[model samples]
Target: MVIDLQNVSFKYENVNVIQEITAHFNPGELVSLVGPNGAGKTTLLKLISGTLKPSSGKIYIYDQQSHNLTNKKRAVWISMVPQNPKLPDEISIPDFVMLGRNPHLGLLQWESKEDFNIARKSMSLTEIDYLSRRKLGEISGGERQRAMLALAITQQSPIMLLDEPTSNLDIYHQIKVMKLIKKIHTLKSGFGVTILAIHDLNIAAQFSDRILLFSNGSIAADGMPKEVLTKNNIDSIYGSEVTIITHPEHGTPVILS
Candidate 1:
């Protein structure tokens, strides 16, 4: 397992936000976390990424406890693209993406030719290579999201966690990003693990190797899309009417409301 959460729980201001969550994520798979707003999905991502420590139990990346890892060590194991990252407005896109290489560099070591190549390739794959000289503050929200993804890809960590990666994108770019994610997963194969927290049910069903359904700060279901994304399960949690049909071409679930 790349990530293992054992009886994990988190609290805020004396209120429990995540409770007794136990799960394991393996490499060579794309996992989607599905839940409504305020369902503790983002909080769970934070815990796994070590942005916040659990109130109880533990999170392990491989055999090491996540909280025990140094910032640099954690960066080597996991790369996370958060929901809203605060980027320096004055930094050029290429310079910002180069920051991903810091985890692999020594103290006082400058970025090398290999580092520049990696960053450039990442930007190209993310379709943001044209914006290399632009300041981060000058881009559209969708473009900024891609920049963040480029930085994460450049990091080349074993585990990738994205929170609403397609949130700011249009339908065209949403599909583009989703396909890009799958492509990355396929190319990386046994060495990489990808996890995403997203709102679009049909997209999640189509792309995920597994789906974790969350409700009221707990996992209501966990399994393949066909098992977890049943009409009853979605309706009970989302409190909305919906129908589930298989895609004619791919045979994955297609949700309609």
Candidate 2:
């Protein structure tokens, strides 16, 4: 799948949340959107996912205009995992995952065997199968996040757009979830990801194949992690004191601020 944005701008009231921003995302890549608070990272994801439209310019997903897609088909092409997953108290993880099959079901159609199989597979892939029978509200924060990921995976979209996916998890599960995402990208040749509004510079640098740093409602830097996460760029955009160093094992990046 491909995502292309050209002169995209969005506004809420008189405030311009995003301004004439242009970007492209390709398949088999994990891209991170990072910036200060209210820098329009999440808003950009919202625009790409069709939750918000550009007030000016255009956004195309795989050459199709976002808003023009039918509702059911939209969920099938690009799935989203929001920061706060609001699962009902009575919804079990298994059944919660079944909701992802909505695009494939008719108005009154029951979930079929294939839907069950896909949901189970997604649960296992997210390492949350053990939480299947548990109520979503009854699970721990990290487990619930994984369950939500399971739901997204069950949607079987080519592109996954996540907004602060690891925000609520502790350090250990944060790494676990990042690794699960990496595994999925590796295992599925055509699958790709875009993460929005993440604050942890080191984690974003470590995981994303590319990084788009936002500043004042526009892209400040866009390139590989090594290029976009440089000390100069970090200082310029974030106004922070940061030292960029290599990771001990992977030699990707390790940031000190």
Write model 2 residue lDDT over 50-153, tens digit each, in one string: 88878999888889888889888889888888888566888888989889899888999999898999999988899888886789779988888788888888
lDDT tens string, model 1, 1-257?
88999999999998888989999998787999999898888899889999999999999999899988999999988999998778789999999999999899999899999999999999999899999779998998878888888899999998999999988789988898899888877878678999999999889999999999999789999999999999999899999999989999889999899
Instruction: Compute the lDDT of residue 190 as modeled in candidate 1.
Output: 77
Best by TM-score: 1
For candidate 2, the TM-score is 0.96
TM-score, cand. 1: 0.97
Error of 2 at 146 (Å): 0.2
Candidates' TM-scores? Answer: 0.97, 0.96
Best by lDDT: 1
Q: Any idea what lDDT model 2 has?
A: 0.85
